[model samples]
Target: MKGNWLLLIGAYFSAVFYSTAFCVVTLHVDPESHYLEGGKEGTLEIWLEGVQNSEEVFEFTINVSTNNEDVFEITDKVLVVGSIKSKVPYTTHKAGNALISFEQVSGHHDNADNGTIVSDVGDVYAHIYVIRSQPLNVFNIIVGWIYFTAWSMSFYPQLYENITRRSVVGLNFDFLSFNMLGYIVYSIFNVGLYWIPKVQDEYRDEHPGQLIPVKLNDVFFSLHGGLLTAITIGTCFIYERGNQSVSWICRVSISIGLTYILTLAIISSTDKFPNCTWWHFVSWISYIKLIVTVVKYCPQAYMNYSRQSTTGWSIGNVLLDLTGGICSLLQAFLIAYNSDDWPSLIANPVKFGLGILTIIFDAVFMVQHYILYADAHYSKSGRFLSGGGSKKGYKKIHDSEKGSSENSNFFRT
Candidate 1:
């Protein structure tokens, strides 16, 4: 019992560490990864990366204002990243400072030009407007919410099964604990920003008309953080007491950790935080470690599977996995169409990949349900029939030896 409690504690902390690691790798993005454009500015050649390296030209109307409240304007037609043959000049605006805004030409690519900003001393601020080259939509939020609901709904049956069995037979407390801790850390990340009421006010005032900036990775990580926390708490209850199902629970945990967790972490970390050198290094190392841990425990999972005579997969978990998967898939597609978010999703593929795995697991779980829970005598037929002609005959005496013999075979085999 003491050992079990110790393991449980260990699992909880492990979950915390891994979840934090997962959130960081998946969500953290470096602002420095974007291009900066503020130096001595003559003709600020603003050229965005275009399809096939071809040039797309945009026209801009420049504005300048001084601390002394003097305002001046200029109209210039420029081809970005390409040389200007002729310079168009109006009354040269006083060198105090300048603001440039570029609107795309009508009836071409729907993409527009982000404005370049110049400091009072003619220094370039490398103003980045991530809004160019994309269409905006509400589908991302909608799909994300759907996925959230599905994953959340998965906990019920798992909770019921664990309670009914009076043990965490087919669940893994350690794995779930780590998963939950990750979600908790993630959910709280952007919470600090909310306390600064000024930020909210400023954001609302300047959004769209002004510079509305956000980190894509951070939001997704926060979402995952909350989801995992709920999963962790539910898993803890499932394994609260060691009972007839402990072995199978451990096995299922190992299976999930192997089939999904490691790959999910690796792909997301690499894709989302590629700009963070330290994060990149740590993420790769964690990925390798997680894979190793899962592999090392594969035999243990197999043993439990054999003894349990079931897949040890939970319906609730499968439902969550399936729901999360569909939601994530839609999220990926939605993100893919936008230029700003495309980088983040492409940078971190864990959400996308794990979503796929969850779907596969959902399919397997249905099979497990029919073969195991729905048909209890399915796997035990060979053993039961060798001794007696009827399952009822074995049930009477087997009831007396049920807990011990089953438990013993789990370890001996």
Candidate 2:
């Protein structure tokens, strides 16, 4: 308890420091236009530094311009800053800075050619704008990383448990099959959309204004999902408890049929059948993935219900998955709230809905394991029942043992 308390305290202080560092406001004057001339129009550029750390919509108010009303006129009274990480430095081939541009209107000056002309350039005064702060990025990053970590490690617990027990009796093979299919589709969609040049071109053409930069996190997330799914499938093969109702042939056929149908649908809709744009096909694949994710846990839940126990399933995996799903949902909410982009939430319903459903299913699993079937277990003779009655009586009863033994051989090598 004392160690846990110390860890909590340390985490709290670390979070506080990280948040402070992330939200620190810094501004730099652009060297090119620090000095400005009046009457002659020139852009007065002020760069907002550390904008990458901000995940909220904010306005940098030019309060100084209001004070210099008599001397100078500014075009933009307020500048709206977006939550997107600025690629200005990379694109413009300059140091990193979120550029804020303001047009300086002509200032009042005497005629230089006639009697007397006062140069406004020398006398012109430029003042710094006060930034209205929003520090949602700190929270977003923290929650995002937590979700990533949880998801990345989620499969290990179940895999380890299966290996140690040398059984996959309580696990639903259908659940694994569906999950692997979903991740395969998801990985293809993610990689094709972001990395393929042809897809990038088509996507840019379709949505010219939207800038969705594929970050390192996205790549890692996709890779992690794919890797874990493969590992879990391998573990399932190794720890076969012979309880699988679905045959390998049927599973393979279903996978191929689904893939073909999705592909055909995408191709038929486009002008170019086989040579259609990557973006169009990826959209179809994404929807398939969404459907798969929605129903992914159904098989496991049903198996648990029928067996009245979660004997072979790892509670650690469920807990980690639950944490990851909740964190993912929270991260999305934070992004939408901070950016004031409610439309995005509606636009990507699949991502948001998947998180919500995963969390709900995780909760149900917890209830089944801890409350509903608390004392449920499988007997040595392969009968599943509550562990409250006479153990010898249940063991001696072997009425169903012959049937179970026959079924268990179905998947045996």
Candidate 3:
């Protein structure tokens, strides 16, 4: 009889154990990453997500860790927060990226300490940036905006120059062709990563616990750039294009680009490479854009060099490109120093190389315009210039535009 009673008690405990799970308590960091000046301090809040309908007051003992001890000093101690949330303060000793993380030591609830167990989530974390110059943070931010705006605005000058001169005589067709192809592929990459849920899911699944790198601004930039390039290409068709055509070299390059993407699409359809998924396709398109960035300016630069003049090519474009490139590189330096993330530059060599390469090409263009080929003015009338090549083209354009050129924007440059 006693054995039967004991068996009934054991059966009851087993059922209870099988039916219930430990209550989970979630802790969230307010800002996943934050910036701070050297020798300054700031606080990041830790908010608790507890079981629903339970008004139980909870407290936890938290522990802290940091990546750089010299730049950041945080000792692991008991964090006693007796409410739903608490602010954690950190101090930056120097200029370095300080990675801060928190661990839960123990936790308690006011009611049902035994029957309702509280399960602790692994960790809550945030970043601490100790920038070299606090005042320069604002400058860095401004430069970031400047580069973005400058790059976006840079496209207009060429478009205007084509309309103003009524000819794309000195504008190398090779440059346009490569640029158009690049923007198209870039738009595809950005749109896929930014909007397509399946691609995002694939990206996240491939890189677990990592944030999606693409943002709405990225989408905006690529799409805006693509639209502008398309319009410019359209203008090429209507405008008086002198003795120039999309070079066979550029045609072959474009063919390769198309073939590369299409072949990847085919491979993705098959199971040849297990890892060649949707995200891989997106990444490959981005690679094409990267390659384009590296080489797009070559044709334009070479064309200027050959012509011994900066006639059709816009100096405004060169100036804006220079502004964007310089700002971009400086901002990169500021960010890398502040975040102690020098490796990230290496990780994204395409973007870094793009900035450096652009700056170099801009310098070359500036030298060509200012010193190497300074004889003639980049004038729309081409009347005062010494070159007959420009004169002949602009005279034809002037005759054609005598009726419509009055409304041309004088302030376009």
Candidate 4:
């Protein structure tokens, strides 16, 4: 027991150390700048440095006016700077040179001594600073893949145990139903936000200089979750225990199907009217997913409480799920740090809350299994505390005519 406790403590610290190291290595801010001549209505050639791809593009904007309130009438101009393949230093003149000229304007300076001071037009120098994005480090990538693998395989142990036992006695169908619907909506939302061009364009416009592209592993993770839930639902149908209500299956299916159809309709409308409509639609779907995830575990927890036993439920699944959830939350933090876009975490509250909620439910399940109902048992000898049944209190019965009975009768001492 002492050794086991030591190992658990060591593992906990190791995880924390590794996550800290990963954040330090991957998250960094490296700002690069260039100076351009700015004055009258003219253009300046801005050199692009460290741009490898000819198709790469950067958002360029010029603020020609002074910071003083006396010169606040100048309007800012925004432009796209694309890489030039033929250039020696790979510049962005082809896309459009920086227009560093602003209209001449005059404004009153609110000074205590001077009642009003008018400012004249002057030459304004522009400093172009680009917020460069660094690709994820190899260690972070490996950790992400590990998280994906753990999440993808989390349900397999429970599925295998159910099959081996040929009973779904301990598993709560309501929980599975909610979980399936949640994953379906989550998968749709992820794909719509990532693959839909309109949504992607809006996201980029709203959040400039931030990289939040959805990876292939993310798609796989959602799909895997949906697939596992579907399998579990099938198993429930096949091996449903005595007198259990399986009628909820049809209701949940129809509701999910209709919701999916409506989601598709909203996504399709984006093609005709392309704008921020898709973003709103996807956001609603994400909220639904979050709410479902938050409530999905309640039914199972209640079931365990009412029955006073955790029999037939696999603890292995809970442990794996806990590990995956912690890793997922850590990965999200790392990404937010790396991109320097902490607001993005709040922008997608569902994704932000999923890992935390999963870990909480998994911990509750562990408590229910190993702590609350540790000695409770459901057996043929009737409901009794584990190790309470005694062979000495049972009498074997024998039949005549060369027949013997394996049944035994139990009596109190």
The TM-score-based order of candidates, best leading, equals 3, 2, 4, 1
Question: Where does candidate 4 stray beyond 4 Å?
Answer: 1-137, 196-212, 246-276, 333-351, 378-413
Candidates' C-alpha lDDT: 0.41, 0.58, 0.70, 0.54
In the range 87-157, model 2's lDDT, one tens digit per residue, is 22111111111223333222112322221111212222343221111245666778889998998889889
Local lDDT at 379 for model 1:
26
Give the candidate order by descending lDDT. 3, 2, 4, 1
TM-score of each: 0.41, 0.61, 0.74, 0.56
The sequence of per-residue lDDT tens digits that candidate 4 reaches over residues 121-211 is 1222332311112234344566777777787888898898778766666676667777887788778777876788877656656654334
Please, what are the lDDT tens digits per residue for candidate 1 over residues 350-400?
Answer: 545545655665665555455533434322211211122232432222332
Per lDDT, the best of the predicted structures is: 3
Residue 187 CA displacement from its true place in model 1, Å: 5.1
How far residue 39's Cα lies from its native spot in candidate 4, in Å, is 32
Clashes of each: 16, 1, 0, 0
State how far residue 142 of model 1 sits from its true place (Å).
1.7
